[model samples]
Target chain A: MSAKKLLVGIFDDDHTLIHAIEHIRHDGYKVGEVFTPFPVHGLEHALGLRPTKLHTAGFMFGATGTTFALSFITWVSTLSYPNNFGGKPFFSLPSWIPITFEMTVLFAAWGMTLSFYYLCKLYPGKQPKIVDPRTTDHLFSMTFDLDGKDEAYIEKLSSLLKAQGAIEVYIKEL
Target chain B: MSHFESPLREPLITGNKTWKKITDDIVVNTTGDIKPLWLIATLISAAVAAFGVFCIGWEVCYGIGTWGANKTVGWAWDITNFVWWIGIGHAGTLISAILLLFRQKWRTGVNRAAEAMTIFAVVCAGLFPVFHMGRVWDAFFIFPLPNTRGPLWQNFNSPLLWDVFAISTYFSVSLLFWYTGLVPDFGTIRDQAKPGSIRWKIYNVLSFGWVGEAKHWERWESLSLILAGLSTPLVLSVHTIVSFDFATSIVPGWHTTILPPYFVAGAIFSGFAMVLTLMLVARKVMNLEDYITIAHVESMNKILLLTGSMVGTAYLTELFVAWYSGSMYEQYAFANRALGPLAWSYWTMMFCNLIFPQFFWSKKLRRSIAFTFFTSIVVNIGMWFERFVIIVTSLYRDYLPSSWIDYRPTWVEVGIYVGTGGIFMTLFLLFSRFFPVVAIAEVKSILKISGDQARAEQWDEVKDDDVYKTLEK
Candidate 1:
């Protein structure tokens, strides 16, 4: 599926990339993915991307962690073994605060990281579909799927990209 | 430009470097032959660490009897080192996680090194507590996992057990947070590496095929934010729990309600000191003076001063409460820390932590590299003594006067302490060799935000004038 030809527009700066993103979307072309050396502020809105739901996932993971920690402590201290230490109550809520807090953080960190990798389709030893190596350096690149677009429209898109300060444009297949 | 971006906002990466130059500057260290000084430093550190391991082996063979810890001072050096190393570990996360959350741009220059310090310090920290347990092989028993021993579930009510969970969680989460931040920097290096070279391939795998896709950056930003948020509280909790190990006990000096906040503040204070110590040496050795500028040093000095005063305040509060409460045990503990046999240590800590940092109130001393370097070392010593005072002075004299004993560390314990330093330096030196010491991507992100436009407006009226010339030092 990744073998399909991709039209990539390379911009010299993030400002030009933002302009090109707006221009390409306005010209009624389906904008695919844009790559930059860093997160260009407002590039998401420029591309009309929906807000990511990863934070929702993070909150859920954090909630689950808190519940699990409290439940495990309660079950183990009360139901499971019930050994008394220092004459404090078996379900010592104060002592439980540290572990509960630790668990919540542990779960959220791991959960959010794994969710990020999964959502981004990232894995160890995976081959990156790079349009240009410079995309990770200084150049900001936008890629378009050329599978269904007509040649004339593609040419128009290229000219539009050039007009918006694109350093170069190229076609490639991943 | 952010309204917050101004002359006061330090040019995080100095030299008004371009993205390519930033990448080039940092990647050079990773790709180059090991420098002679690095080799010497690493060798010395590795040797010290090896000696430490030998000491551990000796102690294991001879038993905990090898240490000077007696019945009265059961935790003299072992737990003291544990808390000390852990306290030193706090600065990295505070810089990487807390500073990131606050959007402190100056952090970009120093966070990479600080995070590396954190991982190494935690590794060093974890070593003491485990070895302090006489039965080193049975260390796994600290965890609550089911074992062959009948119905002996680890006590959930124990603060020691909470420490087991807290330190491990803190270590794991810190490692993740550190690695996550490294991904983009690693990707930058991978892209710059000679294609098909070993360096390229290694970074390629390490970078997880990161291509800096706008969407990936979006998710990356979210992950960083959430991790920072998570780590902010986690760093606080780890130290608070470490304090709980003492506070929950009935020991006079250990039982104060103020211990938690005091420990956390002291941890951050010490941690920053360690950061400055490593960073100052690092900036000089790695020729990163431009990247880690004087302003960066001054910024950290300000933090040291703030946290130092807080620590001093906590000290006075503890003393005040002890005196006001009329608890002879508490009063004796506070008084003994000052006028006791360990009076020298107490004064050293006070002078180093409280008096020394007061010099930072003068902006000149704060910005002076030599002064900052000296105080960073002094502050770390002060913090270590702070732990010693808390643990040893308190434990030295319990309720029973007859059981009082003066604790002195054996050679083996001293070796192990020195070994942890060796291990920390060895790991850090190796990290500096292999990893992007300055976060390339983050520095690049803020190059325009802080470095370029601010410097351009402040100096050069000509918009086209390259600002690098103005940064000539």
Candidate 2:
């Protein structure tokens, strides 16, 4: 990815950041992103973002796991090495319930976490670009793209951030 | 909504601490000098664990015959310890997963330590099954793999095989869940570390490059919720599978419909007790009384009370069903458990699992640290006896009266059991000494809600002078 200069606003409080998002958007300035130490309540609404549908992915994974477990057990019990186990039915659906249920959970938990990591672009060794270290500590940060913004407009945005109780406002290349 | 719900109920984290103060409070413990208690505790545990390792190594060399297990009492202390340890692991998932689903904020304080307990307990549990097999090296035979021993295949119909899959899956997923929760906290510790130092470098790698961006938080939130949903059922299922190891068998006491739920309740009861036992020690030793407040302790006591009653109900139901079914074998099994040579164990289980938790009904007792700590230890001991009563007593007298024989654990078996405690304590001590025992990020998330508002208000009334308040304001 090409490194680009971006305008960043660091708010001290979550409420101030939320208010900054609303005011900046109203002022016709696009609020690129807001970062916080914790998930600020209703920040998504302020930023106008969509709710996540990761649960849908989880459901699909769970269904796949259930099907795979059942079919595998059935195949193993019936065709692979079919034997009369205590004179029970070859495809004993009742006895297969435990493994079936467990597999569903196993696959879903593992599948959903991996997908979450992929979606978030997080892994073990990949160094992520951080806006500010204190974003993880106690600071709330908002980033705006400065691709084609004029210097005067940038000055206005920084002034607005200060007016909204920003702890610090600065620019970074990422 | 009121700013403070219960003024009397202690705030989870005491003190009007800032972000830096909290970081310093928890992280400094790791980097600072080890307390004398920590040193003594670690040394004792490690030494016991080493002795246990010696016992196990000796048993491994000699075979399973070194223990007191016999033809009649084929499954004894080893399996009992296995199930007990596995049961002890259940609360971690329940706290981390189920409580997350239910939106219990109090869990944020205890879940980190409990999850650590889960992983360590599972590690200890895993040792038993592997060693219990006379041929420890051939434990891989439990897996359903393509093999060439006369074109043999695994018995998929067997609950034993299901256990292999269940425990392994439980351990791995629990590790993931625990690690995922630790990431943000680890990142916090990393951020607080001195730049370019060993602490920073080590934490930097462990934190997985966490930046706490909102997008990452979004995914983190979703991942947590989804994992919680997945793990909720898993907590129940893991114990159910463990119970099936007995319930699926044809033995009279073992084969019962109530075993799954009964075992699940017992698992949670034991797990929570173990958490309390360890957390009580940690809270005292680490000076984290505010974070792990009395309310947290009482809340856990309530769970112990609830689960203990459920276990008691299961025990009664098993007895009622046994007598009502008019099955001679079932009746005999129940009778033998109470009146047989192992009657002391059965009574201990009854008293500890059923009778002791009744004291928690007293609000005074539930909140008292001494009472809570004592009960926690007793409950765990009771849970171990519960396993002993169930496994050994049932197996002691088989269908044939001629084959009836009393089983007593050899010193070797007792050493191994003690060794597991050593191993568990050693791991827990090391984990506490090095890692963040509390979920720092999660605790911060609830600061506005669950924090001590009295102190916050006190601090807030003078916000003009407080540097941290200026940032918040």
Residue-pair clashes per prediction, in order, are: 0, 0
Q: List the residue pairs that clash in candidate 1.
A: none
* Alpha-carbon shift of residue B195 in model 1 (angstroms): 2.0
Docking class of 2: medium
Summarize candidate 1's per-residue lDDT along A1-174 as a digit string, tens digits: 558788888887777788778977997888888888877888999999888999999999988999999998898899888986768788788778888888888888899999999999887787787778888888888898998779997898889888888888888888
Off by over 4 Å in 1: B1-4, B458-473
Q: Rate the local accuracy (lDDT) of all candidates.
A: 0.87, 0.86
B282-328 in candidate 1: lDDT tens per residue?
A: 89888898788998898899999999999999988888999998989
Best by TM-score: 1
Q: Candidate 2 on B1-473: residue-level lDDT in tens?
A: 22444333457777776655666677776787778888999999999999999999999999888999999888899999999999999999999999999989899989999999999999999999999987888988987677778546666778888888789889988998999898887777777776567877788778787778676787788888888887888888889989999997889899999999999999999999999999998988887886899989989999999999999999899999999989999999999898977888899999999999999999999999999989999999999999988888888889999998878789899999999999999999999999999888888777776678654564555556556456656
Best by lDDT: 1
Residues A29-119, candidate 2: write the lDDT tens digits: 8888777777676777787778777788889999999999898888878888788888988888887787788788888888888887788
Candidate 2, number of clashes: 0
Q: In candidate 2, what fraction of native interface contacts survive?
A: 0.58
Interface RMSD of each: 1.1, 1.9
